[model samples]
Target chain A: MAHVGGPVRAWRDYTDGAPPPMLQAALDCFVEHGYHGTKIRTVAARVGLSVPGLYHHYPSKHALLVSIVQFAMRDLLDRCESALAEAGPAVEDRFRLLIECLVLFHAHRSDLAFIAASEIRSLEGEARSEHIAARDRQQRMVDEIIDAGVAVGAFGTEYPHEASLAIVTMCTGVAQWYRLDGALTPEELAVRYDTLARRALA
Target chain B: MAHVGGPVRAWRDYTDGAPPPMLQAALDCFVEHGYHGTKIRTVAARVGLSVPGLYHHYPSKHALLVSIVQFAMRDLLDRCESALAEAGPAVEDRFRLLIECLVLFHAHRSDLAFIAASEIRSLEGEARSEHIAARDRQQRMVDEIIDAGVAVGAFGTEYPHEASLAIVTMCTGVAQWYRLDGALTPEELAVRYDTLARRALA
Candidate 1:
């Protein structure tokens, strides 16, 4: 079940590419003002573009949100896959690697992580389902790895499904409270989370 | 460290009282439209009152948000105290009971929990600080329990602070994904989380 490479291959790598200025402006607006509170006009003004000019790129406010969320997810998935590739076939190693990747992603990209977690409600229809599916995929990955660990006695949790959910939830929560200026760097936080994740399954 | 009667005595008990209709209407609007997206007029319309009539009861949209968030936190804190009171003197028992209470609250009161978690950013000035202080109090309770457990050698986790956070994060996350119609009742979900919480500290 621990396939080396699959869906992660399909995601475009935006790891190094900063969001275009317009998208960043929209994201900042959405962050400061909830998605519903933010106006396309506000995004346009922030980006120093006309409404039409902003629309020329993003089409709509909803489109900008989708782009931002997707960008965050893709970069995360890309990092996850790369980490897993180097983790080899040991389930414990893969588990630790996955958690580290998640903690780092949530902490290092706290704003994007916060938006992705908070604004899922604002997404509608197919976009909502698509976003949920993508999120479920991430959860499923965690579940599978945990399940495999249990299968091989590499992990000891009886409730693999719940453990996976809890681990992912806590990791996602790093976005909620993690401050870049805080005592722990993202790497230190990742190490701390790695230990906690293991204890939850150990 | 586990002082029982201090803060709990000072907090008003709203555990059995549902929020008033106007506040409920405001909460519904805030939940549907992010705090930024909701209007006082909309909440007024939902409750069949004129704008000034609504303002007479609740001064502004911000006031509504603050009231709703405070309601959620007070109820949670009240319940946490009651649970802790009955949990006896053992650190592990208190730990289990606290997690159970959190899991149950987030699952049963998913809407309030969701708003409390998601809309904290929408709060401003003193309201934001007050809300956060209340929240940190809850975390500190967990931290104190974990630290006590660590001191007694009942909990093996070296990273007590991180473990406390991870446990609370996972419990709060129940609000995001829990559905009443889902397979698990709140009690059942609470048991699952209780096990995971112990595993994290074991």
Candidate 2:
């Protein structure tokens, strides 16, 4: 189920063109202590800057969180797009690619994944709506993949939408407990997840 | 893969007594705002008791958290034991039974699951070690099941431990996002999850 033939890139490599250090630091702190528990000083300290300096980059703590969330959402969508493009003509291949991308994303950017999965409720107004839309889009991608698989008779499930939710939930949950120092590398972890995802739909 | 059995009573239900109301209130507060973010006054307010009155039951906020964690861990292990005993001989049936028990456990006692998953690290000394041991024991149960499945040639996986971790992580994550008013009941959710789990191992 692992995607063959690909140029792997680290998260930092992807962010070099337009880095958001303050947002990244804020996300790390938020993932560690949650939104309400994280303080501006802690975020600033993580970036080796003063609170005022961090504020100069982000207007407020809430603003920092909002920016971080938006950033992660956009990043996830971009990865999804790439996976869709790289995935071959086979529906099963596309499905496997999507799950592998999700696991890889969670394993690599766990701090961002944690916030994306858990902290959207803390956002307000347009920010919250935008994040929700992005989340729905991601969910829709899973739905579409399952629908395609079902159409091709490659997957067997009574409820496609619920199966999609279970698959996505199982993949996203990787962020909570996965460690960089664990037994498997991110790529290897993604392969294992791909197998589980395939089995889930089979 | 559904377990063919009636509902099994958990240790908590068969125990001699209920927990102190104060501790229940504390668990609710901790689940809502988290441990570091929760205040004694807030718990007191929720319970309709003075701060001093609340302290009469538990000496400190940390003490309340410790009590909640201990209760949750003990209850979870007891439930797992009962589910295993009731599941009978089939590996798939046992796995489904365990998943059903966990889904019901998380549905009725989400606060406890949340506290056990998130706040246990805050505990110190023997309290912390005790919680860690319980968590490890739970992981071991899943590990043993997967190992048995592999030995019997009923499950095919290159990485059983990783697969087990994925399954446990997925089930535990339901507590973080599932709502009572959602489209599925706890039983429905369990069935859906069992399907996904079976696919994952197929």
Candidate 3:
């Protein structure tokens, strides 16, 4: 029952905390082995703990997946929101900052970002709802920015909603390929995507 | 042993075949329950066969994943390459056509597309190599188009490689969120992204 439903949250508050170190370890293991291929025991061992001890941290493998997604989205939204707030009154300025926020997040904390996008299907019940809400919350930011821009003639699109999705999709993909050792640093990647985003809307 | 080493294939050709009907069945199960979550038995049963029958079709779950990704990529590459070939000499025309092909493929064959992008890490050895090669071949098409565009002063980007990757990444995310019943049709989405892509590069 994963991948159905749309709901919005308050959107006013999202945590900016780095995912706990265990989440990082679990993210690593999940990336190496598909969620089904990964054993909970392996995650624990990676963190220098036993399987039982791992349960003490998370009740089940599903819980781990849920927590990973929650924190990842939360982290992403927090970054985007802050960036949006920091940028000045102009919609284009805010739009440019949002792209920078997204590309840099994907480039910098790629593993967590990877799980955030790929592991949504594994989420169940409230976890799925909560995660989707966080995603929609992020999408809503893009939608609002675009909508606002369209209203003021700052942006022009016959398909404003799809434009938002395309922007997020494009920015999110940075995680799939970005590497610390890669040719372009996160700052550089963000700059390039920023240029692309401007051209897309212009 | 997943995610290792790259090799080039004879990239002389690619075809856009309708994925076999059987692929649809497998893609469903994989989406509901990721590669590891799916069972050979369940997949076979879905097709009204014994586990052994499924084994006759695919040697292992990993094999199943490899086939899915290869076919899905083939389908995508087929579409993108054809569009790239068909659009007139202008880089902008080719680029616009390329966006339409990608957006449409991801919108229509979303489940398979999801598995194709998300399940790459589950493959190992030659399977992984083959799939990445197919992907690189597709990326090479984008790179060539962008390089030619820049060479001819049709497209202007300081970072050609990152722009290509970002374009693919943005276009690919349509699968994760698109619905046939959603507000925008594939054609509409493509038109919108085309505008965005042009602006980004302009």
Candidate 4:
């Protein structure tokens, strides 16, 4: 299922840019205690700031969450677009690259991705809608690839939309269980996932 | 991919046993505000009890969460075992039934499943180990089936463990997105997933 002709980029090389100091602290606290369990004070304390000082930057706990979510989504989408551009025109190749991108991001950025997945409920109003829209955009990338693959007989799955969703969900879920100390590297896991995904489509 | 010899059970018919009043209220609060955000007093208030009164049945907020998680895991494992037993001896049949059972459990008991998946971090001590063990038991069910299928040449995937994890992850993820009011019913989604899973194995 891997692209045979070209050099596959190292999965570790693609990353959701490192979060700033405050957001990194917030991510740590949120991952440890969850969104609701985390306190603005704790986040402030982590960064050696008073509550009022932290407020000068993020304004609210929700704002901190919004900033983190936006960063995660933008970084993921940017990587997906770049992977596609680098993957050339074959739909199958594009599909493999997208899967690798998703699996690697979820595995490498597990904490940030975990907060994004588990804390969607904490986001409200405009943040919630924008987050959902960003998620939908990610879904659409895989959807279009599968649709194109099927159109050209490169993939044979009858339910392209649901197949795309299943593929994305499985990939996104790498955040929930993947461990850096575990048996597989992000690169190996990405290969395993891409192979399984391509076989499913076949 | 669906079984053809006998009447396939309705996805709606298999259900997690409902929680009584207090646990249900706790589940609601946890789902809405999260485990950390929900107060013991608020759960007591929802059930018309004082803090001590609610504590009579469950000692702490963590206890309530453990109860819910235990219930969710027990119910899911029981359903999966039953689905496999009813599926007879065919590896393909067992695989399809297991996928349906997982999809149905996640879609029908989404709140309970969501809490179980998201709040594993909140579980402490023995409860955490027990929850992990039960989850491994669920994973093992799929793992063994895929292993058997691969051993018998009924499924062609080279990576059985990885494939099973991908299948289970995608199916379990239904809890995050499936809705009662959505375009597809649980049964329809189950069939679609079964088709996708089977094709992936093929």
Candidate 5:
């Protein structure tokens, strides 16, 4: 299912822009502890800083989470756009590339992906709205690809909208279970996901 | 497709063997405030009890989370077994029944399902191990069905294990997005998913 010709970038490339060391440590804490469960003090402590020092960097734990989520979402969006642009002229090729990118992102950056997937409930107001907006944009990317494919009679599913959401959700879920010591590399997993997704779309 | 035969129970029917009302109340708090985020006092207040009274029922927050996860997993397992039995002799029928049962469980008991999927990280020792065992058993049921279908030339996928995990994850994720006011009924959603999953398995 992989693209056979031209330069194709993997989804693992997107997470290169990571948070700062302090924020990264804080994100790890947030992933292990629910956002509500994490304390600024604990996050600071993890990075060898006192509570007051941590406060200097992040006004609150909430700020840290907001930054982490926005970063992950934006990074993913930016990468998807780039990858899709270079995914050749075929709609099927573009769709497969999107799946590969999504699967790779979820597998490679499981922590950030986990926070994005599971902790949205802890966000509030503009933060929550912004995250949802980003998420919707991501869903739209998949939906549009399906539409493009359907336009060319390349794919058919009765539940187009629901199928879009299902495909996105299925790929995002790789973060929940993909393991470092497991059998497949991130690339291999992405290939398999792309294949399975093709089955769904076919 | 809901079973048209004798009474086909919803997956939530299994969770009907609910915890005590107080523990149930505590579960709501845990779902919102999270395992580390929730205090015994909050659970008690939600149920009109003192912290000491809450402690009288369940020793700690950890206990509450463990109870909730185990209950949800066991309940899902029991219902799936019953559903598969009545799903008849055809592998395709059995596969469709699994998706219906899974979609119904996730939609009806979303909170419990969410807690089970996202909070395993909060559990420790035997609780975590037992919950994972139950989850694995659920995955194995899905896998065995796929294997049966493949044996009969009813289904085909090169990555059987990965496809099984993907399908289970995809179905379980309905809990995260399925809303009571959404476009589809639980039954409607189940049929759509069974259709989509059949595409993947094809």
Candidate 6:
């Protein structure tokens, strides 16, 4: 299968490795102006590509938006899964790893952070449902960690699901105010948030 | 002072009364389809009034949006202050009260939550600055409570400000997903969140 001008390839297959720059430009524009407010022309201009050239890469503006979100979600989930596997079987370590992933995830992909926090609702039909399911799965992973900790007497919680939600929300909220140029590095923020989560769950 | 329709009553005063059926209609519209997307005529029609009648109560659509945010912010801050006073000088009690107020605030004024989270940036110049200051002041109150807790050794944290920000973000994030018809009441959610905060700081 030749990776030519196809919707799936334009969105998913970056084997040729040219789509990342376009996606990066789109992410920045979308974060600043919102999905509905952003225009393909602006993204193209930012990337130094003609509008038609941009369309050669992405069939439509919505396609670009969806691809950005889909790629970011997949990337985040993949990182968390790996972190969980590498952190081994301890529930506390797993939770800490997840929190750390969240902090670094937000730091590296602030554009995705903005979209995940603000633009998910704008997605429609299957895309919307898939995004919601992905988000719920992420939430459920946190819930499972908390529940396991509670079950084994490693973590104490009055309500595991609510506690999990609060923890995740607190960590994800870092994306709103965190600055790469600011005082703390993503690693430091992760450590701080991990401490906060441990204390919250303790 | 007569509470009837007149310029003698500021926008703040009108919010104290019934909130006019039209304003409620407008809020619903604004929340459903953002501030920029809502039409004045639609708001009027929802409340069974002429557009001019809607304009009579609010000078313009921009004023109406600002009024909604201002009213919600004032109400939330007032509740926080009242809770603080009623809870007295104890750090733990103040923290608990603040969380309780936050849960209830998010539950009651979900439209305001949507607007504050998504639309405040639309306001320009003095209006925007005023809203930001009010938001910062609310945050500072939370910080003060956390600092007091740290000072008294009621809370275990070297970074009181960061802990306070995390707690506030966690609580506010509830509004994004909370439903009145959900399994947990606002008070129940508050208790759950309060426990999480205590643990995180512990």
- For model 6, how does the per-residue alpha-carbon lDDT over A1-202 read when each residue is reduced to its tens digit? 3535544223323244322889889888766656666778999999999999999989988788778778877877877787787678998889888898887777656667777667775677787788888888888889889999999999877788888888888878887668889888777888898888887887
| Local accuracy of candidate 2 as per-residue lDDT tens digits, A1-202 | 2433443342213334232777777776776677778898998898999989888878898898788877888888887877777776789878877887888777777778766665665788999898889988998999998998899898887778777877787788788778989988777887888888778777
Q: How does each model score on TM-score?
A: 0.91, 0.87, 0.87, 0.93, 0.93, 0.85
**Per-residue alpha-carbon lDDT of candidate 5 for residues A15-105, written as tens digits (9 for 90 to 100):** 3567778879988887788888887888888899999998888888888889899889987897788678878779888998889889888
The digit string of per-residue lDDT tens for model 1 on B153-202 reads: 99888778878888899999988788889887777788889888887887
DockQ, per model, reads 0.67, 0.52, 0.63, 0.77, 0.73, 0.48
Specify the CAPRI tier of model 3. Answer: medium
Question: In model 4, what is chain B's TM-score?
Answer: 0.92
Better of 2 and 4 by DockQ: 4
DockQ score, prediction 2: 0.52
Residue-pair clashes per prediction, in order, are 0, 2, 7, 1, 0, 4
What TM-score does each prediction get for chain A alone?
0.90, 0.86, 0.87, 0.91, 0.90, 0.87
Worst 10 residues of 2 chain A by lDDT: A10-19
Q: Which pairs clash inside model 6?
A: A199-B199, A199-B200, A200-B199, A200-B200
- Please name the candidate that would achieve the greatest lDDT relative to the true structure: 4
Distance from true position, residue A126, model 3, in Å? 0.9
Off by over 4 Å in 2: A1-19, B1-7, B11-20
Q: Show model 4 residue runs off by greater than 4 Å.
A: A1-16, B1-16
lDDT of 5 at A162: 82
lDDT of 3 by residue, A1-202 (tens): 1212221121212223456877877889888876776898889988998888989989899888888887788777776776776777889889888887888777777888777777787888998889888888988998999999999998767667777887888888888878879777676777888877766766
State model 4's lDDT. Answer: 0.88
Give each candidate's interface RMSD in Å.
1.2, 2.2, 1.5, 1.0, 1.2, 1.8
> What DockQ does candidate 6 score?
0.48
lDDT of 5 by residue, B1-202 (tens): 3334343754435335666777688778877777778888888898899888888878988888888887788778878887888788899988988888899888888888888888888999999999999998999999999999999999888888888888888899898888979889887898899989988988
> Lowest lDDT 10-mer window, candidate 4 chain A?
A3-12
lDDT by residue (A127-198, candidate 1, tens digit) is 888888889888988998999989988888878888888899999998888887988877778888888888
Fnat per predicted structure, each in turn? 0.71, 0.57, 0.94, 0.83, 0.70, 0.57
Tens digits of per-residue lDDT for model 4, B1-202 = 3544433443336433587899999999999889999999999999999999999999999999999999889888887887888889999999998998999888889899889988998999999999999999999999999999999999988778778888999999888888889988888999999988887777
